[model samples]
Target: MNLPKPSLRVVFLLAVLVPLIGAFLWLALTSGPLAPVPVTLTTVEMRPVTPTLFGVGTVEARYTYRIGPTYAGRVRRVEVQVGDRVEAGQLLGEMDPVDLDDRVAAADAALRRAESGVVAAHAQVGDAQARRDFAGAQVARYEQLLLSRTASEDTAEAKRQEAQVAEAGLALAVANLESAEQDLVRVRAEREALVQQRANLRLIAPVDALVVSRDAEPGSTVVAGQSVVEVIDPSHLWIDVRFDQLGAGALRADLGARIALRSLPLDTLPGEVLRIEPRSDAVTEEFRAKIAFSTLPEPLPEPLPRLGELAEVTVALEPLEPAPALPNAALHRRDGQLGVWVLDDGGPRFAAVETGARDLEGWVQIRDGLASGDRVILHSRVPLRPGRRVEIVERIPGLPR
Candidate 1:
């Protein structure tokens, strides 16, 4: 195809105009009032919001039973080992008898001897009582004979003395019987104490629990109150958490909560506030609280969490309420005012806002000066001013609209 060649003047004019046009376009985009300021925006919305408190905690059993002996002795044998499930009153281990059996036998023998003594005292009392009766009869016969002059005065007097002696003997025998009975009682008490001490040598489970630790082994010497095995009730597990005292006001018994165990990060267990401790940790400047699981995992993970396993707990202090809310990142401080830069018809404008409680998930409640469906500037490439022209590029991810 044939084409006409352009003139030199025309070519020069075209080249000059092209570059000038390009420069003009660049200037208009960079500095013109109509230029668009790239920014990230989030739409404010009203939904349910709940203020929450986060804390690092540990899983603990409310009732931990330490199995040990009441007296110092050598551990004879441990029947239950760590990780073993035990029932209340179940024997876990035993301490060496070490002459305890012998002591018990001796106590039994003493008890029998005391009983025999009582029996002998009773027989003596009976014999003395018979003698007193016979002596009294003889005294009566002598008095009658003396009255009739058939017995001498000296004989009657001797008979009366015999009766008095017999009465004294009977009283002495009765006193001996009481002493023997008291001795029997003392022996019985000693025997009972020995039996109890013997039973103490055996370690017993105080409640249904899983043995978490073994502090003493068979043949190892342990003192009184020294723990041999440690067990905890799985049903009584709870999370012990600490929060800043300033934010602990909302925490109370029966408040709902969520817990994430370090071992099971994928799972969030339902929980409720159990108690707020009266005392706080002075060094940490934290308030102590306990949270219990509302429902354990359907199929609890094998080898349940250890007694002091690390966990994270978030307590829901208040019920969900509808309110104007925005992403926490959208908030900015200018002129000592706590607020956010919102997009109006003009551009990014700073709006002073009163904020209420915020959640752990980075959503802040807008108490005033903002309404639902308002677009707030999340981030801008350059500093923004009131009425500044802006272009919304995208919505920030994970923000509530």
Candidate 2:
């Protein structure tokens, strides 16, 4: 080669060696064994995987009631707080009963006036009827007297006129009585309506339940039927879970389930599927399913959960009696498929298997590709070969008979 400049020669030499040196140094740093990642695993066994569907939701009340005035008014007093338990018809709060009291009193007074008017009307009816009978008798007597010439013709005519006047007066009295009676009826009806409206001013619990929320404070103006206090029947409370459609396939209406409170992780409540909301929400692509607890937890051992405490719910799926299962650590990803290292006669063999359900424990249900009594490693670190000799380090004690 022609004599090259020293800088050119040095730069060319540095370019090739620098990359090789960097590659070796990077490999050396990654291959260090200072602390081997220790992975704990278990051997394959027939694990009783209670097939379960996992869904996150909150504890909810099955029966909720919002207590408010049937007639709108200002809240005078709130007897209970948000967490207070109340019974059916128990007064949760009271509204400004002054206006209501005045209304009730006015209603009572009107009713009394109406009743008096009715009595007066009845008395007028009796008087009108008696006068009518008396007038008829006098008219007949006068007519006979006139015919026998015992009474003057003018006198007979006058008696007949008096009878007609009495009849007209009776008719007027009867009409007045009917009108008074109708007025009384209407007045009494109006009074009753006021009474009902006043009674509705006292907010009461519709069912025996815990008050989940209080929407109004004293002096707050609330409308009739406006929700002021939220009450829920603790016994009828249920969980509403939004689950992916694919996850929902494993569930059914009335299927057995187990519920764990977020606070009380150790305890599980027995429940049954109440229903699956048929329609999926378009935004979330999820549907809600409900499960009703068999009974309300009494004197909740731990803290009592609120209406919307996020919870993890697992639907109790049918147990796979004879389904194959394996240690979770043995599951290895390879060539875009799942495989596991099995100790074969030739050495360590790669077995392809499909998995079904997992219990969040170390065991997972093996759906396919593994036979009974097949030996598979629990945890592996070394890159496994299709056929490589392996030694069994430990076997699980008390394997299922």
For each candidate in the order shown, give its overall lDDT on alpha carbons. Answer: 0.87, 0.75
lDDT of 1 at 257: 89
Model 1 lDDT, full chain set: 0.87
Provide the RMSD of all predictions against the true structure, rounded to 1 decimal: 5.0, 11.2
Query: 16-90, model 2: which lDDT tens digit per residue?
Result: 999999888776555543222222234567657766687878888777777788777899899999778788878
Off by over 4 Å in 1: 1-49, 297-301, 319-329, 333-337, 360-363, 367-387, 391-401
Candidate 1: C-alpha RMSD after superposition: 5.0
**Highest-scoring model, lDDT:** 1
